[model samples]
Target: MKAGDRIRTVLLAGGSGTRLWPLSRRHCPKQFIRLLDETLFQQAYRRARLHSSPDEIVIVTGSAYEFLVKNQIEELGEEVLHDQVLLEPCGRNTLPAIAWGMRRFADDPDHPVVVYPTDHLIGDGMAPVVLQSVPLAEECLVTFGVVPDRPHTGYGYIKPGDALQNGYRVAAFHEKPDSASAEQHIRDGALWNAGIFLMTPRLFFEECQKYAPEIAEASLPGEYSLLPSISVDYGLLERSGRVAVVPLTVPWSDLGTFAALHDASRQDQFNNVGDAHLFDTSGCTFIHPEGKRVAAVGVSDLVVIDTDDALLVCSSGATERVREVVEELDALHDPTVLEHRLVYRPWGSYLVLEESRFFKIKRITVKPGASLSLQQHHHRSEHWVVVSGCANVWIDGETRLLPQGESTFVRAGAVHRLENRGQIPLEMIEVQIGEYLAEDDIVRFDDRYGR
Candidate 1:
């Protein structure tokens, strides 16, 4: 590495983790969900900070997830600058996402860029290992290859050729193989592709232009809609001659499916992993977000996932096929596939307590100092009862402070807003009476969150 050389970390956070269904949805992906106390995205942010500065780290995600990404980052006690976050108009796959993030460093073509997917689980002390490839970044596009502990068929494999100082030339890139092929690849000393890359902006763009000109061209003007949905491995790395692989010893897992989650999770005495009460369940995994008690009798090698709207019970080996269930749900237009019963908003969040043909009940909580949009419903009228804290309620341009046990009403087509200016969170119970209770009924005159 040179004295003036720089490195930037890019976190790709736009995946809709389909295999971790029920727990992960389209609106709330696995990266934002708390598997432990902290989220996977926050872990990725801390890992990126080890290799680059806060300003040098960039996050590329869809526009719909911008708030969730920002909120998670802020939870780590770090502030994200507007320039550091690149919002894609839509999901265009990894090639376009990486290309868009790489464009921000066009002025500094010599600087090396490291890309990390936000949903993966990686161990600590990765800074030294990641920084080791900085000097190699000048001549080759570097990718980290994990030393596989098992012959797993779920991940792609990377074969290394001519050895370099800290890595090797990428001899070949193999897609996910069957059990026999995975075992053969393991015997041949193939490494698991971790999907982490380190390359200079000049080399990345050059390779993109050489192999994927459409993506390269569309990326320049930010016209990603016209680009093909392809991965960087198939589009660039496999086609480029400058690719190299760095062997990584740090523990890692893609967590692509429930099986992977089971492998990485902590097991109890019966080899079960989860926060549920178990009876005779051996070698089983149970996941419940609501702390509900789940007792199983004589269930072994099974996976049980319970959510508010759906329940999944499958064998441990069948977790990868969870995508089929999501496809079926999408075909039926199930709201469970889009979001959970508890939906997060920019100000706070709301829980769907009950709903029927003509009425809907919700428990709304607004964060301190946060306010809702100044809006009205064309098809509905709302009744709000303050449960705790103080509510700064506005109805038809009239504002008043409603404390605990106070109530207010808003008629249809009347402009209204809710704000929490107190030091604590404002909690309220909202009842809506309407012909149509869908979210599309709102007409915002003004919004603080740019809804």
Candidate 2:
């Protein structure tokens, strides 16, 4: 490693958060949702940018979320090149994701890479700890360890061994423990595994090859699907000898459950932390995402998360088991288990307003200068009524401009497209009559986004 070498940041954002269900789903995870003023991805992006240049940052995400990744980075007013984003064909877990990014930095293996989970939150005190990891990255695989304020059973614990120059050697790695075990670990002065890793590309890839050969051998995107799904901790750090833990002097939370979210968010006098209209509700967190008026009558120590299609009501302590609810929903083939009513796209977003056996209604928003794919639906005919802005509609090679209140009909099997040519967003109501109303029914002729 040289003094002039600059370190880059890699964001591992492919995990599907199951604990934060109803609000988080398979298609849209917690990192992408607008939790506070901006999404956690935005927050993580800003934090990562603090240490690396925009061009130096790499985002490893699932293939389905390629556009969401780009859109979020675009919202930050920074350009994300196509090569800057690594799209996984399917999730093979963190080890593969980090190794894929490390492949890109193979030319300069000594160049440091700071890895962060895009869904986590870190305080300003993390700045010094992160800066300290830069030099430590040259010598060892560094993982930031947070001192446990409480016996948090949700996080993995790190046992510190021999003392290092700036940190400590890893004595052992513990999985999420029971109440008694967690308390014991705290008594032993264990650190919470923060999952933030800083190491050089050569060190990471070498560690992966040594310990996680199955993941390290797969270089192609298609081959990654065949690799076993394993976390970095299980595959490398826990098994490798070249590991060190630096204490993080900052407030941090994985925000993996509703209880953690509640603890992180500011609460009212009643200890509520969401946008629900409470009625005699105290010590309850009501997360009504659709702005539906939720009346919690005399509830305490409860979590009520309401989406347009699903409602989750559980005890505060039971938030960890919410994944079981998602499992049951998946077993029942519930589409609501995967996405919200309002679905996001690269061009913009669309909200499913109504649906029936043969028809579906949607409110679509097209961003300025953005256009939908030039495609034809096999089983659906669509009627679009413009609500705001201007739309340049193309049907069967014929173009027609539609202003607000104007409508257009797209016949079944017609090659049609919708574009927003105006300076503002184009809002339209779409009513579809179809035999099969699904996203996979479209056959695209051309797409600017290379979908």
Candidate 3:
């Protein structure tokens, strides 16, 4: 398969990123977070684009993240030709997602797809590296291996044997090891297993058929019921003999934890990282709000994250165990664990500022030239106060234009749509009051972002 004819891209973007704690929740994971202004997903998308065209790229994301995926792709200016967003009803893990994406491209036997995790941070100028690996991709299942900078027990290890044309034969794949074993593996020249795989769509399915028949069988259309929640590593790569490794001497870090975030993020003079306003901090990672001030005097190697409703403070090394806090919150049925106070949607974003038994106040931001779906609620009435920019409002067969500081009201069961007509972000304060106030109460008619 030629480089241009065979190469395709698959972006796996389904993880919840629970370990990132206050900054990353179920609704807004680490991939969507703007770590240094560019999201991890966007970076991954850019990297993937360097190897394949927009039409050849496939994004596998969960139902809840469909809008975010679409919006991000739009922001990347790739939504014009191919709608690459493949929405999964639910996340069954990497195996099923990969199977689904490969099956989509199975009709074309020549197209080889490179599957990438959307949350990884790779080195600068990765296009040449990816382009160089394309020829090797045709013959074998190529996995990119990061040259281990340290004995990181947080990542898996790859053992390479004989050298290939542009890569090496994969001797074995090792799981996350204990401190001793990890250190030994590092000393023995094992590379960090960066879950980046390149294989033909047909070869991917063929390997699934040989090594992971369960996944292969489940890949059939309308056969999602029997799919087991398994990762691609366990289901295919570990079992496949056709696997190869391409060692990359690149600065790469899977920003999965606060510690990893600290390591990957750019540090200041005081060794502090992130947007948090810090005072007298030497080695701390802070992700605080814009107007919020966080003082860290004489503190080092600490991770501080402050959101609207939750605050997390943990030692940098202990960030791996932060998932336990999410699990604890899950056990308690806490909404904070599932979503932040500021919730994102396809049309706009809404932040719950204050709430009471009968009233709820929210700050909403609608993108310029964007509009909400024509919808109506059965249980709540809404009061919208424009904070900035102009809005074109439609309410119960009446239309009006509202500017900054202007307000409008929609009674319960009234149809409405708030549109941003101006060239700036439309900001509004929304107050809803009635018997019930929930997202599921709305009935959408026409949605631009495809709800």
Candidate 4:
């Protein structure tokens, strides 16, 4: 915008959601997973485009997911600029994340910044309604509230005080209520805090100064770790008197849990979603996205999720307990809960086909013009066979260009690197022979990805 346009969008894609895990993990978040034709992050980007220009939208994610964010945006056929994506060093809740976004307008503190959590499943039509409320953001901290369709205990509630410009003043803010409190809030005309906000940095910082001075002072990413991890709701919105709530009449779901995903997704007459051969299953959600067929019999209101390495089966409405399951897995130090068999990197991705005590096999793909770190393993020697495309291999001081069906070997303690210089992706199968065949056995002499 030229000066005084008063609108910029911030997309919070750094969040790791385990509620829809196996598909959504620490390495691959909910925003990157494709439950439909497009990912939820892409949907949020499209919604942002309806109101602001591509230049006006700022994407905030962690350093680990930087490539996932960029690659997915490119898959949409649009090139994302390097400066457009902000890499937060760590997860410190929405308060610091929002502060990180609004800080972009240090000189233009009066400019309104609209924030959206990318995990939300919002309909396309809601963009126009959001555009209509941009003017209200100048004077009040605007929060887009979803009118409660049902008594959902997971979300925080907001009670409207009085009528404002096409919205209402926030009378009270309620924390995540229980079953009884949620029903009472629903009956009292409270809105579910959709976690969407529109406000200028001036107003936001002023509220932060009053409510959370440490957060206000700790604006830079390096100082972000020092601030207490808190949501914008607890730190600012509830205490700020200059807050307003706009009822979002759009079809929306936070998609925070598998049960919510099932509710929002398309279902058959039996109310079933996903790949499953069912005989007597109704209101059960089974996800077999890998094209594997699963059989279900005489089960209702159950959630059966099957990934290559993990399977989750639980009651439908009790999907919130998946977090507890994750905690238990973490307590056991199981790596399966953190990532899938396939892990994404800036260059491409690698899938572990098989692993044993003495041997491991992996299928690795390198994007064109991308290269892995110049590194070597201490306890393992790797044999690489090119399956397709061309590979530029560097072992020790020797470098050679290998084509499809060619093979190469890198002895243990020898510096080696793999690069794809061809137009197509270089696909290769790697077999490792070692006593300790672990990922941490690598010692990088050099890396372009800053690992």
Best by lDDT: 1
Of the two candidates 1 and 4, the one with more favorable TM-score, higher being better, is 1
Per residue, candidate 4 scores C-alpha lDDT tens digits across 295-326 of 88998999888888888999997899898888
At residue 224, give the lDDT of candidate 2. Answer: 80
lDDT of each residue in 1-451, candidate 3, tens digit only: 5544436788999898899878888988989888767899999988887777788888888888987887887888867355467777767888898888887787785566788899888887556666677778777888999998788888999999899987898888899999999999888779999888888776777788998787787744366646888888888889988888988988888888888888787899987887665666778888888877667666788888888899899887789999999999999999888888988887778899999888999999999888999999999999999999999999988999999999999999999999998899999999999988978899998887666
Residue pairs of candidate 2 with colliding backbone atoms: none
Model 1 C-alpha lDDT per residue in residues 78-114, reported as the tens digit of each score: 9978777788887878988999889888788888999
The runs of at least 3 residues in candidate 2 whose Cα sits more than 4 Å from the true structure, single-residue gaps closed, are 1-6, 276-280
lDDT: which is higher, 1 or 2? 1
How high is each candidate's TM-score?
0.97, 0.96, 0.93, 0.96
Clashing pairs in 1: none
Candidate 1 lDDT score at position 44? 91
Best by TM-score: 1
Model 4 per-residue lDDT at 3: 28
Model 4, residue 353: what's the lDDT? Answer: 93
- Residue range with the least summed lDDT across 10 consecutive positions in model 3: 217-226
